[model samples]
Target: MTKSISYRFALCICVLFSVANLSVADTLTVTWTGAIGELETTIMADTSADGTQAHAVYKLESNKTYLQRSTIVLESSCDIVGAAYGTGETPATIQPIPGDDGASQFAGWPAGNIKTYGEDQSYAFKNLLFNGVFADGSTTLFGVLATYGKGNTITVDHVTSVHNQVITYFCFGQEENWTLTNNTAVQYSCYPAGMYFGGFWWGGGGGWTGTVESLLIQNNTIEGAHGQAFVIYDNGLVNRTEGEVINVDHNTFVNIIDWPKFYRHGNNTRWTNNLFVNMAANGQTRNAANTNIALNNDHVGGHGKTATLYQGACTDSTLLADGNCWDRTNRNISYQNNAWMDTPELLDMFAMEPWCWDLPADSNGVVVTLCDTMIANQSKWAGDSTMSMFANGVYMSNNLHMSDRGWNLDPVYITAQTTRTRDWLDNGVHDTHTDHFWMHQADGDKITVEWPLPMDFSYLATSAAATHCTHGGPVGSTHHMDHPAGLTLNTNPDGIVASTFALKQNYPNPFNPSTEISFNLDEIADINLSIFNMLGQKVRTLTNGTKPAGVHTLEWDGRDEMGQRVSTGIYLYTLSNGSKTITKKMALMK
Candidate 1:
């Protein structure tokens, strides 16, 4: 049936509504009549003094590309095929203010700018950017910003901080629930980050209580930053927080002179599955040794491919390096398929610098290091409850490449976890994907994870070697369809298409009860998914990984940060790979 003009226009409007009000979908048009500032402010106004909000909306004509500067700044999830920048003053550098109160302005700054907020407010944006542009106003405007608080949910999504400098976008808070996935950060720097988290006033010592638990950063492409890519624990912020499960997976890093600085005393935070290509891609003409890749600058991955973390230390922490594909995975692991859950391969034992001392520098010749000390053993350290792979300090397991090296972040400290493992094959004749099933209890107590073995993904790395993958093809080829002989879009070219992303809607949305939200991947890349209330506050994160694509899910019962079921209302589910995006709406019927 031929559609009428009004009906056609309504369909067009619906296509325009990404995450926000769907009603506007039928009336909006993508025209530039020089109206940018007010629209951008509308998005900014969504923020709160309490710091408990985050949002992303990929509103675009499915056929059209390119995002406007105003839309990029105002909207959370968008694809700008062209150039985009934000209005506002370029942020001046902000040093650790000695006496900034959590509720008031940043130390020594004017009023109205809340220096400290809750973790619940910082909803990490996970969006994809393809052939696009981004502009952040000053280091303070926020590409990523986290504020840990009594609120329990850290949100990080596929958001690329690019081509703008002022205030950084990432921050941290008291209770950590950080998840940064598949976002690209390029040619942007100032303040403390091209990509960063300015939270917890962590320069002096680890402050606050409770482990910054369940945080993951994966599958991101970052380049060119003025300050450190990561910053943790101020000198005064240190407070013994243990069992923090931090994961860095399947991401690529380049042109970042200064990497993340660490407190070195905390038992939380894990780094793995990420590869740094040009460790010295920024500045290394006279400083060759400095050019090498070093987590704390103790060693280098070198030009071709070799990187080191933890200043060449071999101690048992929560870190396992597998995403690098080669650098960190070179360590010895004895267990089979234990690819990414192993310790790092340090460069030189004696030459290893202490972690705090070997930080990277910004474009300006500034040496940055984290200094808060005098932490009490009980600070932030939880006695129990950590949902991670290596739940303990360090252990060894047989692996695909080498013998295992580090301890597992076990959710429970018992001898073993009630776990399940499944294998997917690419056989053109008899490939099995959904058939492999096991017993599941539906109880949310145990951590459930699904992975693709090295042999499973070998097709991408070894198509010529028939013995590698069951139904294999060359790298970047379509060899992963259900039938090995069939060629399909394994993942989209932009990485944002529905085919490229394994997205799922929040289950039991608008329910007085809860439901399960799930997704499946076809390959290994960083992933991020979040649940947001209609007002744009991030409520929870389901999963983030640099894991091989298969299937995955997380349960979000109808509840708020306080563990109370929220009022009956509308909500949205967002997923991204920093290149593509998909969103679904669910309801919570009180």
Candidate 2:
């Protein structure tokens, strides 16, 4: 069951999964008992025949720690979910077995902790803790390695990783939908290898192909990462069809040594309502000369670029037939309503550079500025007038940056602050809270009230700025601010227990087709479960009757009483027991 797969073999696997004739779909559940090789053995034995049609759910024992000694190749779609006894109970944990050379079997590509290769499949990992700390500081382990798939839906939700090199890495081909939400990564110090989250070139010359239908990275808390946060790259071959998107929203990134790097995606890419703090820490000099001029503050604090968007070389003329090349204009990328706290003066928020050949050329083949091209193509390039094209095609607005100006009123400090602020303003970045004091916040400058742990970025409630900040709520990630509870397993438990009435968050918040909604009832009571639109109109009543006490779960297939599919938007779900009522929100993203 232990094997290494090459790129060619990986591609073949994807093709095989796509063309294979699957049988009647069935759900298979397996329980683990902390034994070595048993989990993988059970999975392979049960699904050895016609795996594509089987929906396997591998349930790990509650709060137990399991050692993954080798890569587990998933031949089929499945859900690996950990069990918990009750509220505040710890979930099962999976960590790499300690090795002599600090290298575990979960190294990558050829091997990894968990590997899945297929097309048009659904894979979910949830309610589990992954500890990737190694002895010799090896940075090769990938919690989940997925490769070469199209129209695949992958979800990594409610998972926690500690000191992991890469929590998840998707390589080669395109995915219909990929979501990384409600996850927590603590001390993710990976360097000289990979990113904490994203895909990379895996032994290919031209690089990954196809267009991602949708990518959602939301509600995650990344506390400390040494190298990069997200590094998604797409070869400039295919353009996403209209309405496709890559959304990185409502996440908190702090103590990041480097920034997110994205390339050659011409879709509606958005970075919205995110909170960043203490970025570019200790400079971006990773065992090399500090060549970055922006971060040259005697190697103290704030001395690097925040992000870079590159238009990869789209030199293939054959792709031009369908207009499947990198879009140099980058009109669909946007950064809005984001907030940065304790940012240094010189860090450029974003930098966009066209491919070497993508620079505009005149009829005589002479290089010209983007402004020159805009003048020639007036109808095509008409939008923001203030931008000087320094960061072309990027629309930035309503972004807030607050830095502490300490007692040192040096001319260099003042000049750097004003210069960056003016540059942003001139480039069509409209900050609604802009004022004279923004550049000289001597009295107002302060650090987060909850420093280091549970870093709270909420402004004072009395301040008028609080109302304008972050769309009626706080600006940062609201979940898992404090580190997740450590894994503590009770080897012997009486039985399944329920202590309170609770309605848990939906499995996949922005879901397509269907999603699960679960709740706990301490005692038998008459309960009513219904879904309502934003306008307070009830769309469907899932259940309305007396139910016994225990954990109750149901699935909403994104439909109404008339059996017609609902439009994409936020929908409210209410759970009422005649006395106590609990309401929550879920999104149906078609």
Candidate 3:
């Protein structure tokens, strides 16, 4: 829809409803209109004194991309506690203030000039689809002037943009007086359109005092940078700047040609769980490596066809390279504690192959062998959970029941499977999908699947309860099962339902900060409740103890093992008794 029509419709309805008397609620919506074009934003916010609550919506003309010299400040008199900013599709959730005192203001300055509110006072932006036209590097997409104070919190989690010629996502100035945690740039890749620099850049200097200590860079996926993915420069912010901890973890960078430079200032940094591919001419570079630690990272396609690993002026006991893997060889391409040298003359151990810096034996990395030609072909039919290939045909699996489709099939009971490939066929021939017979017991205890290793395509298949089932396919031609019959409920002649356990849906489905999870027990049983991220990594363990024969509730404060608040994302929580295990998915908004 066009912005003018959408804006007119919203304004007309808002004005129409203004006459009706309504009870006061905790939420308020404030709108801002730009002078030129149809540029407007409406934000709904929570009115608690210190509670973090804000959501914004933007409407712009069809051709118009950005607004100039305009700012939208929310209508709230209460002091700013915490704030978050992102797109409407992906709301940037506010992380908890670890030591908030309810009266503390998070923004650096008091509310004043409207233009500087986003940086000076606390504010957020959403639904901004701007195509930046920046030639010189002087302009910043959003600049936050650093002012000294405590209890400051800012997050820019979900932003989508292009034409980042000189566009910086966030620019912070001098004086460090806040803790930035639980920030993310996930799922979407920040592609470099024009002249490229860092996708997310920080630094115009920081405070000398020890207010800000740590920077957590996690879960970002970026593509093709001309400069560095992250750039941190020094302007004398702190004396021993290298002593401050910087964690760069769980990010994927594709085709960063020139730089992923962690130069002089970012000495005290740990690069972990990162995947680097196509670091073209300037393969990964590290300077002032006295305090840098790189571990457990996977890298492929360096400066040239020969995968390159570069180090500058790093001496013994200075650079710690361990448990890192690379696509360097035909097989077993993994290493641990890879010894590196300063120059080719120092290659006395491996004389013929002087570039062999990593120790030959006792390597700590795992390598898998695959030809360059086979990598693309084999990747198509590999790693998917639902589609498996045998010597004869391809096997498939799905949750939807399709037994009535004139094919011999069995029911599949597994609910948490994501690898089921739909409509997969091998060599345009026979295929079997989800033919495992699942038998549900009287109690909600154990459900098992019984299937033979190899099936005779010529014979008739049998069904449960002694119901004779015949194979149906192209007559006289060999074929496998076509579709899956989902879970089948087992009942006795009396028609009484039986269940030993039940897990209820979490209250307040999309929640902020905290939520309650409840479950029921038919009899006394030991239980284990845990939370896992989409990547299957356990975020937190809620409980590991015994429960009685009743309903029990547990509250999660959206924290991990170290009591740090987690980012906004989809999480899975599982309730596992000894006999049966059930899992459900939930969303953490902030």
Question: lDDT of all predictions, in order shown?
Answer: 0.31, 0.49, 0.31
List model 2 lDDT by residue over 173-275, tens digit each: 4534556777776544343322223221121113433344445576677755544566544322134544334556667776554454332243355676676
Off by over 4 Å in 2: 1-29, 53-55, 85-88, 98-103, 107-111, 134-140, 191-211, 234-239, 263-267, 282-306, 309-313, 317-322, 343-391, 403-470, 480-590
Better of 1 and 3 by TM-score: 1
Off by over 4 Å in 1: 1-33, 43-149, 166-169, 190-211, 234-244, 260-267, 280-551, 554-590
Provide the clash count, candidate 3.
Answer: 11
Error of 1 at 204 (Å): 12
lDDT of 3 by residue, 29-94 (tens): 332233321122222233223322232112222222223322324432112111233333222111
Steric clashes per prediction: 108, 1, 11
In model 2, what is the error at residue 302, expressed in angstroms? 8.9
- Lowest lDDT 10-residue stretch of candidate 1: 413-422
- lDDT by residue (179-228, candidate 1, tens digit) is 45555555432332112222111221233323343444555555444334
